[model samples]
Target chain A: MLKMTFARKVIAAAACAAALIAPAQAEEKTYRLKLAETWPTNFGTFSEPAREMAKLAEEMSNGRLQITIDTANKHKSPLGVFDMVRAGQYDLGHSASYYWKGKVPNTLYFTTMPFGMTAVEQYGWFYYGGGMELMQKVYEPLGLISVPGGNTGVQMGGWFRKEINSVEDLQGLKMRIPGFAGEVLAKLGASPTNIPPGELYTSLERGTIDALEWIGPAMDLRMGFHKIAPYYYTGWHEPATELQFLINKRTMDKLPEDLQKILLTAMKVSAYDMTINSHHVSAENWVTMTDEYPNIQVKSFPPEVMGAIKQANDELLEEAAAADPLAKEILTSQADYLKQIRVWTDIADRAYLNSMAE
Target chain B: MLKMTFARKVIAAAACAAALIAPAQAEEKTYRLKLAETWPTNFGTFSEPAREMAKLAEEMSNGRLQITIDTANKHKSPLGVFDMVRAGQYDLGHSASYYWKGKVPNTLYFTTMPFGMTAVEQYGWFYYGGGMELMQKVYEPLGLISVPGGNTGVQMGGWFRKEINSVEDLQGLKMRIPGFAGEVLAKLGASPTNIPPGELYTSLERGTIDALEWIGPAMDLRMGFHKIAPYYYTGWHEPATELQFLINKRTMDKLPEDLQKILLTAMKVSAYDMTINSHHVSAENWVTMTDEYPNIQVKSFPPEVMGAIKQANDELLEEAAAADPLAKEILTSQADYLKQIRVWTDIADRAYLNSMAE
Candidate 1:
């Protein structure tokens, strides 16, 4: 394992020096890369990108760029993907960037913000709007290269047992939510609790937790949350929940340019593919959920309730921005971009959708 | 070109057979494929996917696959891409599927419909909802394999010199809108015209055309239509205009497995990349357009006007469906997929965006 770190990566390069050395093609070494995913086995679309990327990398490189992925069931530490990749134990990692927010404060901004841009909007920001640069600034110091892995469009606000009609309804509400969204709920006087996936259905089915926000209809349908919680609220907290792909800087430096390109392209293409798959599955599952359970109601918070939550979110973001320069920079960039792009989105997608609605 | 058609595609297959055949590695061949694009050179994001795909394919295969593209200006055949690729004059082509409607009647359904799905929804329809299979059914008999090239979100409803408040206002309106959209307008007593892009600004300026719909802000801003047309309307006609990559059946069959994988991955990834780039450019360009011309009024057709247009669109579609079984199948598939998916989209993205709006 130690020797293989620098032992592989003999790519079939151009026709110059290698052709001169021998009449026949030169011997090429196959580089095998190991990936660690934060999800367990059969984690649905959340688990698709890593598997698809690895398969594509291998096939494109003709077995030259072999990649094997180990899910969290094998790795045993869902949150330790960053450490394992950075320590060079694994060549790559598939995880959400927000998971590292406790360690790296700026990591929270890379994943979806409370009221940030949607998937495509954030994708534009990442590739064309200086997001990749800012992301590298946050990850480069950790000796890692982080890129977008996948997106879950817009997450459902949560499965609420009771309606949130006003600001006062949020007080002392107990829900199973995580990350900065939980903090926003905390600011609004809700008790945000983190529970394991295996325990969520049981917890929600019983009186242990009043509500829970998993992914969208895709994963949540299987959890049977709709059967227990009748009111499914629309999203506000995390509009575009994007996962991250992390690679060790040392591992990246060891590969030939062609192999490097192959790996990066595989990751990106798979990321987009997974996003489309996520949308497909969510749309399919939403229909299945609604059909199987006709009594389930989809609701949105009243404007006053939303306004209050937005205010709390704004204040929390302001305080975070004030405490750190990087936070302020990321927040400002996102805010300005959202303000500009949302107008076009409103005029383009929103208007079309509204005008066409029956 | 004839020598190179079957001359390349000698992939480094596997170790056992290849190593036994030759003591050293065997020499690989570089496959050069020629592509014809509908757009002329420097046609903005429309020209990006082919170039980016060619670059990625070459890099990933280490120059094993090389693709060269000829623009409409070079070939003097903007609408001849489908013919060129099918006739084996070109191995691949970059153009919209709707451009081939004059040649293949069913080709119109693959690009977009009058009032169809948005970018992501259309993408879902293509990848996950049997759109590719239906597309293949349309193109397979023509000796071509067509895949999505890129998308330009929601196309604006063109720049208008005069406001259209009622259905009566569309009487004899000379609008430079092409494709099935023009047919939809023609049903509404409007004189639909097709002007050369180079002469579009002059035509609108001199009253040769009263209004024109080219694309979104990205391409529109450079055309300077806003300087003359003060009423900028939101889209109703062509939603999610997806470009296409047309590969000759012989061309696809000739490539080695690895090279084929590389080429396909590059095409898919570049398609998604260009979609993101389109969104970025439109957002940036929208800001610039409004900033430079503050008098631009962004409006949507009143409900009555939209209803009339939609009625005309539906009538045309119903006639098309009644005429052909393949057309009915494709249209039914899209309508069903859109019906199911739009509910989730309304609840997820539309709800989220509306809640976030100030």
Candidate 2:
């Protein structure tokens, strides 16, 4: 009986020791997160950032920070990513910040603006300039954290059935353009509408719309717009369309410091990777399109039409600024930054490219 | 004695259980790596990538990965990074790939060529257009792995004390240039020489050299060259000026797969970050320089001079290509990519910038 009592005491001591070590082991516990993306399954470049981010996060954390992503098909809510993430249904979301503009007006400014900075300039603005701080201010109030997801460098203006020679060309012109750009065009007496992606090609083919603006060659080739539209206009509205990664603030705060850093870095790197990937795919697709459709003509808007568009864009921006103090601050910051950076861009990249062409 | 035996058995069983779990704990083992950089400590933007990469790697790996860096000041070998990393004396290095041209002539093609692709185009080539495969072929043979470290955007041609109006002006013009670019200038009947960073100012001031090519406004503002040089020429040589990150093959192979991904992703993100940071700093510094030195003239070489330089560059490239099949392959690949992508660039970014300027 005494021996039995001793054995029980020894077992209790062992149990106490195990309990002491358990907490230390828990410190290395694996954290699993779920991410919902606005894109459907295998949505090409749009879907890349989330998958890459998750893989990197998991690998970097040595499998301790696993992030499983559900595409729109699974979630059955393409535009509901923000709501789901905010409600803690998903720990993170990948979508464009502008998509949430209806719910949060200030969120529109985070994505690319009409005639705004290029990819390089915008990235500079986000990282070194005050763009990131401004962006965080808009997102933090919504109980979320937003980072740049990726960039589509210099989106093509649109596929046009006919050339836009002057302001008259846009009069009552029915085109498919979305977001603030559409509003800008609407002010100029053009009817800008949004159509579901699946219906765009059919709509344009059946004369439901005169023209439509899609992504650049990287994504546009798959949509087969170049086959029907003879004139491809250069970009003006969405020069640098930066997608966004959103995370629930509470979800982020709960991770250990290292894992937090890991997740953030993963998102950042993957975002940049997507930018490069977009550029590559665009270059490749541009080649394919030109090779197959040699008759396709690339055009830029005439100066008169462009001038009118610019005027309308500026007026709309003025109205937005007047509507809110934060909008005014953000617009002023972007305009000032663009003015300063454009000078350097002209002397550096522009001059070199022109000289080389000569 | 019987009770004591039972207690000892219990203790032994507990110890065995702990031993069984120790290996799982060992999976979180910390890996420490040492990196050497080509730049001195606090060398402005050039030094940022290495430090940023190290910090991100550590944070992402949850303290399991630690990378420490030694700049040129500590290692006492600015140009020996390639040799040290190859020899496994340092696990990793941050330097420009072209710096190794003296030891490995083919290393010349990886950095930037005179009138080569811009940063965006170069990145496309690297990631999508078989540039990585070619680069790996060159470095793998050397028992090292080289990845792009960062970019300086478009480097300025140089600070010139005299205007270059024609090709005749380059005859016997003493200039401080380095690497393959110096070779190109030599073909144009110009006397090109290398001057250490510290000696460049005095050399140009005392007329030891008539002009000098350095980085752009981001790095050059502190050098105070704008105060003395009357003409700031646009870039032709080293258009993108991509720096390199080198790793010992053995060291990289020894790492766990997760840490490997972390290290690679960290390097890549930091590199892209530097590009944005360089643009930001340049924009800021350009403002500062112009504000202080209003007379600093930004010049592009006259077409005659630019044409002559291009002819010489082509001749040199031809000679290099003829010397090795691999060099020929790499050059052909880059030329083909540039040809295809430049068309898209011309229609897209170039047209937009020109249109906006008007």
Assess each model's interface with DockQ, reporting 2 decimals per model.
0.46, 0.39
Which pairs of residues collide in model 1? A25-B25
Best by DockQ: 1
Candidate 1 Cα misplacement greater than 4 A, ranges: A1-26, B1-26
Pairs in clash, predicted candidate 2: none
Model 1 residue A316 CA deviation (Å) reads 1.2
lDDT tens digits, residue span A1-358, model 1? 2132222223333322344444323334568899999998999999999999998888887777778899999989999999999999999999999999888999999989888899999999999988999999999999999999999999999999998898888899999998888889899899999998889988988879989899898778888898889999999988998999999999999987778999999999888988888888999999899889999999999999889888889999999999999999999998988888888889898888888885
**Per-prediction share of native contacts kept:** 0.60, 0.57
Residue lDDT tens for model 1, B272-329: 9988888889999998998999999999989998999999999999999999999999
Model 2 docking category: acceptable
Candidate 1 docks with a DockQ of 0.46
